[model samples]
Target: MNQDIELLAAYWTIAGDIYPMGPTEVSPFSFENRMEAAGQAGFKGIGLVHNGMMDTVDKIGYPAMTAILEKNGIKHVELEFLVDWYLSGERRRQSDKVRQELLEAAEALGARSIKIGPGIGQEIADVKLMAKEFRLLCQQAAEVGTNVVLEIMPFSNVRNIETALAIVERADQPNGGLLLDIWHLERGGIKFSEISKIPARFIKSIELNDAHKYAIEPLWMDTIHKRVLPGDGTFDVPAFIKAVQAAGYEGPWGLEVLSDTHRKLPLEQMANRAYESTISQFRK
Candidate 1:
């Protein structure tokens, strides 16, 4: 393993023109624009999320997008995905196909990992069930020469670093890993005191963002609502970064923010803000 820690610039959904689009105003910073911006910003890589995949891919074919990533010297892209289609039920084949699509996407984009937000339901947290299912996914990911990184989201069944590690432990595969997003860490009810307990080996990546005390009218009426920028909000992002550092996690860092207000401002400016906020927190 390289063991090098670098940051991957993400455009959650540079194309979503609707409700859950990213916080930063959608910029002309399309695939091409991101490539142009990467070197100047010192973004070691790109964390590509579906927060706009549905619309973005529809507008531009995956093959085309992948080509763009390659031309830009981007070595990998971490995809945001729903991983429920891979269970031992009616949708098993459907699930397999989805995983294959991810594999294909990796092949196209030359990505290293896919961020798997495993579906949660009554049986999702079942120890044995999640293990079996995750193991299968890991096997598939290995075959594709890619990694499966479980992302911890607010209201998630595996909503914290602890739960994420537990599930990965059960999976027991080298390709299995976890993603740490600060927004989810803050909202998922995890405190810094719990950091030492989280295993360092499984931390595949870390996400960055800050928030405020007063909540915005729920991003939607749902539990996984919206979020603000790194410095604009009230969350203690610097402390969170320090905790991750103490935990011995050395991996790619992602500057992620899900906001509409951000989008209205210049995308380049928002990206600069994210870059600045991340540096300030990492130093703290």
Candidate 2:
């Protein structure tokens, strides 16, 4: 049922993008406020940034967050992006530990998938090496009953759908799949045809964030710093959604807007605007 409907919500990271005026992304918003606002805004659910539940996930742990979500009727947390990709040595060990934490969070919070970026930079120069690395990640993810959603970010080595899919194919595990972000789609210059041709099996999870034209800089800065609402800019997002449907994707199509401008208003207003804009785009 990827096609026959519409679902949307404003990401807290967008709140992070906009900061203070956005969605109380840092401190003061509080869990009570966030859930209350989201419930009132007519959203299906939220795509949580793990850090948002810092008090619960970090301090009190997963079950507390799950109880909170269950108590509020917010059972659809789609993606959990674990952002500590570039760690090595003790930090690498910590990465695995943190990953376990995420899985626990998922089981506790009812998260469907966990997003994983395989670090950054030139280490991915060799395709085979990254593929093996991905397999290891998948094995770990499977243990926690969470599929590892491999995010193909512009700044990372597998910056496009093709490369990410290739790595997934080589990794040869059921738990490994693609997480498509539109900013990555355009920045990586991944063609629509390529996106359409991706096998149904590869795209386990997906994300929708939009962008305005960029002046060109490092890929790292672009993925986070320059994203807009899905339909507000030039991403051909509806067509992209159609491509996902055309390829048989049946997963959450969550909005991940990162506009610095949009966050100035109340988050409920922002969420409504994002939800309405995205729903309108898919109307055709």
Candidate 3:
């Protein structure tokens, strides 16, 4: 694969979301199968959710799981979906357990980052306290040779690029940074002009997905099941790409389409479409 396309990643959702019922009557393929399809489609990296990674390890052993990725020529691995780190008491404790396991898994797999967010509600906590908690998480991640990237969701505490940047700056950990997902970027009303203001060092990762210019009713549902492939919707993907590139953020661009429609496709078709659609944006 060429260097540019080699920087493209296929996220786990491109395979399936690990639903018990599967993405469709025929889907929800195994982790090994997903990796092989993604590799064959020219993706150099693959994303894994925390629970999915643990389940795969339980089934195949960590060594075998990593071996599958290696055989597929997958170089970058990302673990995701850590939540409630900003809460206290039982919630924080529960988050800690999952966080620890994900950290260890990331270390084991030499993952690029652990994707985390405040989840689907508005957070009213003190920004400083949030930064402190994030700093602690970054320290833990640092010890394991991984990065902790805060994903900004429209309904979450870190709801915009400005807020996400504030938390990252206050945390002041080298490994603590922001994960910019294009769907969330548009949903949060952040313009590409604003994205250009961020330094490349603080932009830890970039995930690509497309959605309508106007939000659908009950936003979360659309986010989970309706995201379109790059260039298939109203998002100004080429502008977004140009803005990030202008900011000097040179990293793997992750294809993170979480649509029910996408999941229903056969693995090879899904992977190929994701790779082609994403690469088409860069071509523009």
Which structure among the candidates has the greatest lDDT?
3
Worst 10 residues of 3 by lDDT: 18-27
Cα lDDT, model 1, residue 182: 77
Q: What overall lDDT, based on C-alpha atoms, would model 1 receive against the true structure?
A: 0.65
Candidate 3 lDDT over 25-100, as tens digits, reads: 2235788898888889888988877666777778888789889989999999888878888889998899999999
Q: Tell me the number of clashing residue pairs for each predicted model.
A: 12, 1, 0
TM-score per candidate? 0.81, 0.84, 0.93
How many times do residue backbones clash in model 2? 1
**lDDT tens string, model 1, 139-208?**
8778777788887765546766666677889888888877777777776678875776767777777888
lDDT digits (tens) for residues 13-52 of candidate 2: 3343344223444534555556656656555567665556
The 10-residue segment of model 1 with minimum total lDDT is 13-22
Off by over 4 Å in 1: 1-5, 13-29, 50-67, 86-94, 120-124, 216-225
- Sort the predicted structures by lDDT, highest score first: 3, 2, 1
Tell me how far candidate 1 lies from the true structure as C-alpha RMSD in angstroms: 4.1
